[model samples]
Target: MPAIAVPAFALAWWLACYLISRDPKRATLRWQAAALVSYALGVAAWTMAPGSDTAEILLCVPALCWAGAVVALLPLTPTERRSVDRGALALGAAFLLMIVFLPQAGRLVVLAPLVGGLTLLWRLRAQVTPRMLPAALTVMTVLCTAALGLLLFTSGGARAAIAALGLDLLVAGYLVAVAHAAETGERLRPDLRRALAAGLAVVVLAGIPAAATMFLVPAHDGVAALQFVVLAAGATPAGLGGQVRRLLDRLALADDGPLRSDRAALFLNADALLRRRQHRRLNTVGETEFLRMTRRALHDFADLNRLARSPLTDLPSVERRLAGREDQPRARARELRAVLRESVSALRPPGPFGTTDDWRYYNVLQFCCVLGINPYARRPKTDGMSREARLAADWFRRYVPEAVTKQWIREGAMIVAERLWSEVATRRQELPAGPDGAHDTQPVNG
Candidate 1:
């Protein structure tokens, strides 16, 4: 089982590394991938020389790799990418010191990575929200700490199985954490959030019996404890099945308000425009295609009002600007204007613009001017934007005076709108009829 476990873990880490490597934007995943690669190497080394002292020393590689992953997960400032390198080096140094101290430092070495991860979590508690990943990590940490204590203080067949279970929990926790981090920009629906919470609650409830069996039942062996934990974890999903169904029914009955087909259409158009930019394939060069592109770009401009309100803004700068300022009429006016300017500047595409980049800025400016989104307003005229987005709207506004006149912006927007109407009409005509023989002329939402 040990031999199989080594190879299985190695293969899983290798696959995870491969998938994470494909996306450059996944900084945390990249570090985790690197850690897994390191771990795989250590496993291979230990497998080749299981009995050797050198092989045992090589196990430190996985420990360092785990520490590296924790470092990667730290919430650093936006400008400070790759801060994990310094943290990893420091951790490596600590590991080396522990080795030099030998027998006396053995327990310290085991505790080091665990302590580091928890310390980082503690420091970032304010920034970290109460989410699925963090909750899983907390549980995993507690289990791991207990497992470590058992290993140091006691030893037997039960210890090995319990240790294996703890490792499994840690691996599961890491996977959940990475998945959550990857989708940090996504907003969770209320129903989904409730479902997740309920699922977790069920798991906790199932574990209570297991905990009682382990601690209260004095005659139970290590094997019995291990069995109970496994059974409890496994039974959680099955036990929650009825509750899950009820939650689903409740969710279905809940009103989600009217569908904004226009917003959906704009998102689709923006995606199409981005794809065209990426592929650099101008399949057709005509007035119609140009107008289509312009229409998409204009939609993107309008969408910027929502996008700019992202929580990724320079929060410190914002705080500083608004600090100690009362909400008096004059002060409120100044704050609004400042935020509007900031918001507009946030929408500006970085680097030099030509025909290639010009469309983005043009779209944003045209949308702001034509849509009549007040440059000095505290909030967007439209509702439904997230709090982060509203904050962005509060800080930034459009800049339209540079290259084009207001007249040109307005005219260009109208031209795009006219072209969009014609294109939609053409598409509706081309669409095939439904089964009942009536033409299904509903336009694509996005």
Candidate 2:
């Protein structure tokens, strides 16, 4: 791409974003403007940098700085606002300076600290909102772009390739760490404390294996290979750590499940009363209805007091509820049950799959179960016994038989697949019917 064209592209992008920002309905146009400007500035950095040498690397710093700046300026909780702003500003400034003066080596060093620090600070604040996450992601994009540009500029061939792979793993690992933090609602400092402890454990786990790899290979690249192994391992847990954090969150909020909340029932009851008054041609129906609604609200409130409360992660009881299958213990099933119990606690009501408001929790449990069943394949946990157990594990007394669990997931997956295939199938059979006809819609094999 020509150098002049880069700036032109930036200008056009900024204008588009600015126009979008003007519409009150799209109030987020301002952020979009920031994103566009950041993009243009980064492009300008590349176009104007010394030669064509590592232009992307140089540009990444400014781009990321712009992204970080945007995120920092957004409304955040007082505590979160302070930490995120401090960390983002610190990293953003450092990266920008590196872009200006030391484009080459500064790129690599900038990413490790910038991402690591932001992850630490964001987690420490224990704050997350839809806006906050997107902003954080934008900041992350800056970090990644810089790192990739640096790798492209610095090395070539096998060395560069390997380094790029390593960097990718590092980014993935950091994301996992961030996820862990989000799930736990742990302040950055507390998460770091746990990470440090886990790091020691990782060191122990890898010590001998790494040593053996080094000794057996006895080459410089061997050392690199060993290092990669450790990083990859660290990264894997960092990814899973977020999940554990979410589980912890579920456990804490265990008593807050939907079945215990009477609001839905109250609404139903009040609606019925309103209908009755309308039929009687009551003159003060509106005011009377309001009072009745309020009364119903109070009645619903009392139900919160009525339900038996217990820790969602009271593992033994959850395990017992699921019925301990003597067959290999279904480690996946048991673990999933623990997670589901937590979901039951965390979910609000009117969930898509679970018992209302708990849909998101059901979604998460299903994801974990699918991961356990077919780690190689990515599938939704929407159908099957997993979904059933996820819905009922905390509340249902019956054990989810192991075979039922597996069959449910399999059949559910099959039903979905068959229906999709049937859509495209030439001699189409009716989309296989589920037991509940239109509602169940799960396919049965002919």
Candidate 3:
């Protein structure tokens, strides 16, 4: 049963990795999925190994592979050239060689990866901000390392118990790392928090039957007690870490403007969300709904460019590249229009113009261009617009070409959506809101 179950799990995990890797936008997801595949393969090896000296030595192969997977979870630095898979494989091979040649020093081989991971974590401490998640992961890693260490040196019933608990800790540690990667700086949804809590509750409840089984078999290894304790203890920190961090954020006394770290985190999340949404099929009904969806797509498009400015690598080079690309403004205009057409067509709308707030910017830009009205002409008669909207309109008319202005409106919509998603990063607190609730700041010129 163990043999079958383990390999089945490994296959399922590898399948997921392959499926997720098909999407280019899911970089982080791909990295994680690859790591999971490596880890699963290692587990499968360990489970299938026979009871012999050769088998014992062969176990180190998977052990190092699992360590490589753990190392893959670390965030990449800006200057880092090697991909995570390459790095993981290189490390795995190095560890494999050590264990194979020095069978007597197998325990040291097991310890090597943990030390390397710790060192990487230490070196990356400064790079990882909104530190709570990383800290929790660190604690879990340390605990798993300790458990693995004990499993290596210990014997008898203690060894069996430690092995069980250590495996549990390692699994729990991976969960923590994945969760931390997914929800690092962003606020976790309430349902997710509750789900985590419920999972922990289930772990605790499972301990009862295990303990009863141990009681029935008095001479057996005390695996039940270890199982109960490990499950109960292992889940607490992983679940509590986010809850506590969120609480502290809410209670924080000073409102230091959103940090660079926050912006970077937001950029990552926004990009991922946009990419995912781009691939989704639109299912809106009626012209109004279609226009609304179009507006959303426009906003997403603009936000992508705005957020793209903050690359993980050299910022100046990125900026220069973007600037140089703008030399072909007409080409950009065509591309933007193509994107808009693709998104708008998906909703099967009754033309781009509609009698709704969603059509306001689209109508204004279209009308101005069709009439060949002086680009700078301001319509004071438009009664519904707030001061910010009026200013934006004026800016559009005076300096922006009609096609360019339309593109900006699309981008502006994305900025607005981003603001709605997380006001902390998007809102300029010093600037007052215009009558239409638009911030009175310079419009994004993209």
Candidate 4:
């Protein structure tokens, strides 16, 4: 492999594992991992053994994998999702059989899946895109178009080199972008900015030295060795070092310190809950801005993967649960989510929901936390508040520590988001099924 392909393949593999590890139960990540692995193999065969029977099988598999992954990532109905999945399998089996038995026909048959995948994308253009992600969707469209254009125009060794690399980049970029959109919607802007800067940094630090080795070294294999050495020497300190820092930060957040009043830590500290470093800090953002910021997060809860980070992960209760196993951030997040649900459920009031006497406790959590109802605003949401609710709000305003109230908001929002996301992200039947079991579009086949 070329020195550049080494890093490209390594990154693709690492990112594939990262996405799967986030939530393996999600079919989207599994399909994406399959695509990456197959695409890497397909690129290898295309550049090295384009004429062989084995190479045709290799190309056919990745094309199916790529199309299946795109269908999986979209916010499609479960029936639509399952239909495409099974259809892809059926078609892939037939395509490989043709490649094995009918050599000349199968070479032409392999392109069927790729064209089908592209056509499906064009048809589902409206449904596939998540809100506020038009730019990312546009990038994916260009990649797909470019991959086809590159394969059609290039010929000979140039075709294998350029077209193969284009397909590799296209698959990798599409999956990564989709995975990121799933995690953080608005937060993706800063993440992309950071990624762009890091990519440029790698080019400067690793690419320059590796490029020099091509001319300086005499033997071809010797040059490849030097390129790897130079690339690692540069990447280790600049790239790996930052990853190490974030990893350490994630795993070592277990400070089993006492909570206020010397109680065992059941939730986050005052400062951490308040996001002291960010503008959302209670003291930094006045009551108005605090309400505005919290409102924005609540409004966009469905797009985000997890609740805003809570200090509940540090609870000694959580520590006891993880005593035997390794300290993983993923485990901590799962435990914290469950605990937050139970914690908020305890505050539910008796009787029907309203702004009345019995509803004070639960509604306090509702207004101050989830709704961001600024009672003291110039134009507060107090018109709907009943007399008992108003008095209860005053008591909370006077007695509750501002930071602790902030903590409650964090916990309350976690509960609300968990419920909201269940509705949005659940694989339940959304749009009504059609006569054909929602497989309006069939998987591409020979």
Candidate 5:
């Protein structure tokens, strides 16, 4: 098992690292990463002490991690971290004995969290949309339910196989489903397809040994049977997920655009992620992605890292401004910041600010996204601000729909993009070109 696990662990962990790095602020992704790491560590411990007390103790931890990880993936709205997770910890305690003494009962141990997660899903049914990888989730729900049901007729050993297989199928489908959902603007997690191919490679590496263990090994010992479960969960073999892809061209999470549940988090995770995101992907940004990126840039207002990563920096005005120094992110960042500030200033009305429909866009952008105010917080740090900033903060907390704030950001982005193009046009007109400059050779996008 150790010989086979070495490569599988490396690949899975690599994929885990990539996903977490891409969306460091996503609380859900963080939990998922913890689950994967905990499961892998349990497997490593078991292989080192194939049937020892140490391995048994180590194996117990993954089950707890899974219990929590499954809950974190729940379709939560813009809620705080502690408030949402208290139940998972309580529920984990309820399953403590089974997870400890009957660790070999893989199906039953996994069933607790699976059932708990589904129950939470049921409660949040209103949040479920076809976009959150309904097809893959539907398959997962059916297969795992069926496998657990089979425990009535099957023996204990067979339960291990049933649970192992279910875990294998889910890991692949769930992660891919999450990634696909993210790509479609369904979830806040950065696109998982970034490392999915390597993820599939992990399944291939671990599947053979885990499958062989299921059929040939004696499951009489607790550690041995539990070892296989960890291997299965860790690799997240791609069998059923492969079939899911071929059968239904459906996989994703729901609309996680700023509107989804990000309101509850108030884009807090995104703000954290932006400050850390230094890598710049030079892809063409559509209006929606453009708005999302720009809004995040403002959320991390003083942090040059976010502005440096802004797709708005790709503007010809920005490019022309930088000339040969386009590679300097901070320099580009400075210009992007200037453009954003100008756009925010434009949101100001002709007279003193008032909490009316006319002032909605200004209030939302100025306080929520740009100024980083969270009035709903226990202690809003509005101590030294002007009366208008305070009123705007209160108005945002009381009046604005979380969803509408994102649209305001979109409008703001449009303003900034137009201003950039306007600046470019002005430059094109002013440039004293060479003799044959009759040809309009100015760059459009840059």
Candidate 6:
């Protein structure tokens, strides 16, 4: 067989495996037969193509057709999406190898259709499964290996294709695998954490070897190793795992609202509670798309609370007054102590996610959001005693009466303190008590 024919066959084989795995009904035997037929004809045509075989293009045609059919038939699950892209990448690598080994194999005709199909498949499989993705990539790696063999045997023109395809597959595979592990949630299943950790370990181990080869292996030999490392890192998981951690942390603030298993809303019954002022039994909004909207609600609440307080007060000056000098606000802060005392009494110990300090930060952030002042705003570095309290000082100066500005600042400080206290209290309440059960009320800095 001509040098290019080998890659053509390999590409068709990889697609055959990918399609079999993803198609609703595994048509492994049928697709494999079709792929073999196509490769056979393409090789025959290439052998007969005037002086050189341009017939390799035919191998990809049937593969593309089958992939399209599979895409149409399969339900667009996340696993299916990942599978499609991975399979396509593998096929593409095989095709690229053909171009490298056998120079005159009608490059665009072979590559263009392959790339187009892959792009279309990627778009279609947008909601892919973490598991399916790495699996597909594995198939691609095997095809790339065949191409490398061809390169080592061939003398010129095709060497770069061998090096490039090998490296690309190595890197792409690792990245895909890493991402999948990181994205999968440990909390979803007791074993999920172990699975994720194990997957990451594999990538790490694989990465070290691959990375070493990238630098140590000559241009051709090292290419495969380097590509593998790149893939491992890129594919490290993100979506579900990251979101789960965030949800757990937010749940610790359930008393601020309420926490439920449903991820459809952010705070408990926030949507219904926030809308009409009925304020019936407290309902939770769960961790849904509504969380983002709730953040906006917090912003609006601040504006309204500011406006309703002291109608005669100057808006800017009131903000400054509320955020005023510490001493003055501290003295007046005692007035509101009673209002918050009950909430403090109900507080539970901190949970695994945060400590008392973290709770305090959360409340400070909430208070600032409610009052329309950016909590993160920086204080003046050079300004001495007078300008130190930019946040609390400015808020009190603008909103609280001049007589109460000092007290407002103090009250604000108390709010921050209570938040931490309540946060720890809640954490302790969430978990069962015992030596094995940790009641950590620590702050999460990130």
The model with the greatest lDDT is: 5
User: Of 1 and 3, which scores higher on lDDT?
Assistant: 1
Ten-residue region with minimum lDDT total, candidate 4: 276-285
With a 3 Å backbone cut-off (N, CA, C), the pairs that clash in candidate 5 are 78-264, 78-265, 132-252, 132-253, 132-254, 133-252, 186-256
Q: Put down candidate 3 lDDT per residue, 1-446, tens digits, no spaces.
A: 23232322323242333324223244334444444444444333333342233434433343454455446456563224246557666776776677667645354466576567656756776644334545665565566455445544554332342344335434533453344333222122442334345444544454345445545654433453344344434433333333334445546723644653464444444433322222112111222222333343343343443222111111122224445464222233234444344333333225533434555544443333222233454544446655545554565566556555555455544443332223222333434554665542332222
Clashes of each: 13, 14, 3, 0, 7, 79
lDDT (C-alpha, whole model) for all candidates: 0.42, 0.37, 0.41, 0.47, 0.52, 0.36
Candidate whose TM-score is highest = 5
TM-score order of candidates, top first = 5, 4, 3, 1, 2, 6
Residue 103 local lDDT, model 3: 46
TM-score of each: 0.38, 0.27, 0.38, 0.45, 0.53, 0.22
Off by over 4 Å in 4: 1-26, 40-61, 79-84, 93-105, 114-127, 131-154, 157-168, 171-186, 195-305, 309-446
lDDT, candidate 6, at 6: 31
Q: How displaced is residue 31 in candidate 6, in Å?
A: 4.7
Worst 10 residues of 6 by lDDT: 280-289
**Better candidate by TM-score, 4 or 5:** 5
Which residue runs of candidate 5 sit more than 4 Å off their true CA positions? Answer: 8-18, 48-109, 112-303, 310-312, 315-317, 320-324, 382-446
Candidate 6: list runs displaced more than 4 Å: 1-33, 44-51, 60-63, 69-113, 120-130, 134-446
Candidate 1: count the clashes.
Answer: 13
TM-score of candidate 5 to 2 decimals = 0.53
Better of 2 and 3 by TM-score: 3
Give lDDT tens digits, candidate 4, residues 122-192.
56666444433444534554554454344434444434443454445444445445544433321333433
Model 4 local distance difference test score: 0.47
Please give me the total number of clashing residue pairs in predicted model 6: 79
TM accuracy, model 3: 0.38
